[model samples]
Target: MAILITGGAGYLGSHTAVRLLEKENDVIVMDNFTRSSAEQINRITAAAGRAPEVEDGDVKTKEDLERVFQKYNVEAVIHFAGLKAAGESVEKPLLYYRENLQMTLCLLEIMEDYQVKKLIFSSSAAVYGNCESMPVSESTPKNPINPYGHSKAMIEQMLEDIAQADPAWQITALRYFNPVGAHPSIAVGENPAGTPANLMPILLEAAAGERDAVDVYGTDYDTKDGTGIRDYIHVMDLADGHIAAAASQKHGFHVYNLGTGRGTTVLELINMVERVSGKHIAWEAKARRPGDPAENWADASRAERELGWKASCTLEEMCLHAWKWKEEMHKNTQKGE
Candidate 1:
């Protein structure tokens, strides 16, 4: 029985694939390689000493998914294939919906056709748009402020509806907090195609001279340092949470918050990265982007109680591993040049 992972070559997807492979699970990776790469599979192979079968295809194209279903003995799926940028999604709402929601619908249809019942959907905390309280719980209201979050919320509801209709469908949506950092090996991690978006990556890119300077979005928000504060969980910890969710005994539609249950401000995170990487990073303050929140962290108690998992990595560890990967990638690029 193979676990099919959509967008298995992506940042979070690839990390989850590595963990699944390490657990001795037969894995099938389906990706379009638009915002990913086949080399990610190579890194997975190196890390786990085993790699998933790669299907170079898109989920929106039902034919590609059909080919994978027919070829492999898929038992469960972890869907992560989609455009994930909230800021970009604000500019192109239709594009986000067309790719994320439509592809999810196609995957669900194919899974039903193939009689695959188990699914673990990758979700985001943005669904709880600007929660009035701190440490948002799983019961947080679904008030997405942007197109990207709305797309995720819609799919989550669709999964809920499906679960209600069928009792046997095992589904769990892991609403992830800010997923940062890289694999410790420096062999596999995010491969930025251009300028990075997230804080950790952008900070690392600046340290490695890949970018001019990191832009601090929203410098006055009434937080520790007036910058946006978020729960920055390491990618590996998030991957482990997915594994726990997949292996859980619980059934029906469920939601779990995978986070460190702590908030770190932007300036605080930048300081940690600088301290860990030993690089005097340069940064500039910029206005708050649309759909941005002042402060948001997770009340991940549900995941701990249900999945028997919690993020254990420290902030320094996250910064250290991320910098290692960034430096290694920069060295590789220099060699290529």
Candidate 2:
């Protein structure tokens, strides 16, 4: 039985694929390569010690996904394919809605056709929408302010409805905080095209000398450092959480927050990256972006109690691993030409 990973060439998807393959699971990757590079597929193959069955197609297309399901004995799916830029989602709301929602719907139909009952969905903390309290729980209200977040929330609702209508489906919606760090092997890491919208990638580029300076989105938030606070969880830890969720015997729909349960401000993150990478990060404080939360962490007790999962990596460790991967990426680029 193989695990099908949508967008397996993307950052989080690739990392999760490595973890899955490490556990001796047969893997099949489906990606359109619209924003990802073929280099990522090769890197995943190198880390996994075997070339994964790669299918070049979009999840939004039924015939394409059906072909993948038929070719590989896919027993489960980890859905990671979607548009994820918060700022860009706001600019192109329809594009986000169409791509994210339609893809999930088509995939669900194919899953039904193939009788694939297990799913691990990639969700976000943005669904909380500027939470009024810190350490948000699953009971917190979902009031997403952006299309990207709204799409996740909608899919979660759809999953719940499907579970209610059927008893055999096992769905786990893992709401993630900010995922930073790279694999310790440094074989693969985030390779964003053009400008990055996430904080860690931008900081990593600045540390690697690919960019001049990083822009601190806001510095007047109500936090320890008066900057927007976020829960930074290591990507490996998040991947572990996914594996645990999939292996659990619990049936029906479940939602768990995968986070460190600790908040790190923008300034704190920059200082940590600078210290770890041994680079001077020249940063400029900029105005707050729309829909930016002042503080958002997670009460991951549910995940800890249920999945026996908790993030063990420190912020410094994450920065160190990310810096190592960035250096490796730089070296690889130099050797390529």
Candidate 3:
């Protein structure tokens, strides 16, 4: 009767857990705490008014996953556990493949063993590689140029094959665009490990004086401002999409693109963040990151029509929410001293 969330201590997973709790679904959080923190668990408990059933275990381990399934009468799973650094995936392709692909395989096997059929996977837009058009649809050719993207693509394929073999399996792979921002209360937000590989987190760090300056990757791209353009969706919106997909009466393997259906360039995002935070963001243009796309937005009609979900927040709202979270984190750190 509980929905199990892998890596529930993470940013998006934690936000999704909050939403699930809001809907009155009992949540069982499974995490190894490798790249996450216990502070997130505390925050989710505070926001949701109840602590989720926490299971400290790795998804890659069969015993670990099985134990969790046995302990909690898990009805479904929202998988968010995996390595996500695009650049690092290129260098450590084997590690990426082993962690991402192997973990999914292990989890699926356990799900089968436990007879839990419903699964909602957290996929990325990186699976699309360099899209031919601006607004990418679900039918776009999946020619992933990076190991990270390839890993996600492989998982999608695996899910399809699994569903085809068994008719009872209900799988939904949500291909997410760039997810930014935080919960409105500033109770929880992204906490990246080491230097963040994503633009939004890096920009926020620069604004908070945690970093020297933000590096604008590839300013020569053929975009509105000669910078890369990406569809930025709020973390909360992405979380809502996952909940909708999980509760759907529909069956079989399906994929949905989650985005705002509009593109924002790197420069525009930087300006918006600065304006929202009232902080000067020092930035420098850098060479293009390999496997980077010139522009990528989602044709989110499927999510709108099928799931009855559409992003309602604006770019300014996303930036303002993220700034508030960052500012609160700073004040909390100072107060603790």
Clashes of each: 0, 0, 0
Using Cα atoms with residue i matched to residue i, what is each candidate's TM-score against the true structure? 0.97, 0.97, 0.97
lDDT of each: 0.90, 0.90, 0.92
Q: lDDT for model 1, on a 0 to 1 scale?
A: 0.90
lDDT of 1 at 270: 84
| Candidate 3 local lDDT, 218-334, one digit each (tens) | 988877789998999999999999988987977789999999999999999999999999999999989997767889999999999999999888999999999898888778877
TM-score of 3: 0.97
Clashes of 1: 0
**Which residue pairs clash within candidate 3?**
none
* Residue-wise C-alpha lDDT for candidate 1, range 1-337, written one tens digit per residue: 8999999999999999999999999999999999987888999899888878999999999999999999999999999998999888988999999999999999999999998989999999988999999889998788999999999999999999998999889999999998888888777888765666777888887787777778888998988788999999999999999899899866689999998999999889889988987887888999998668898999999899988999999998888888888888888889993
Task: Judging by lDDT, tell me the better candidate of 1 and 3.
Answer: 3
Clashes of 3: 0
Best by lDDT: 3
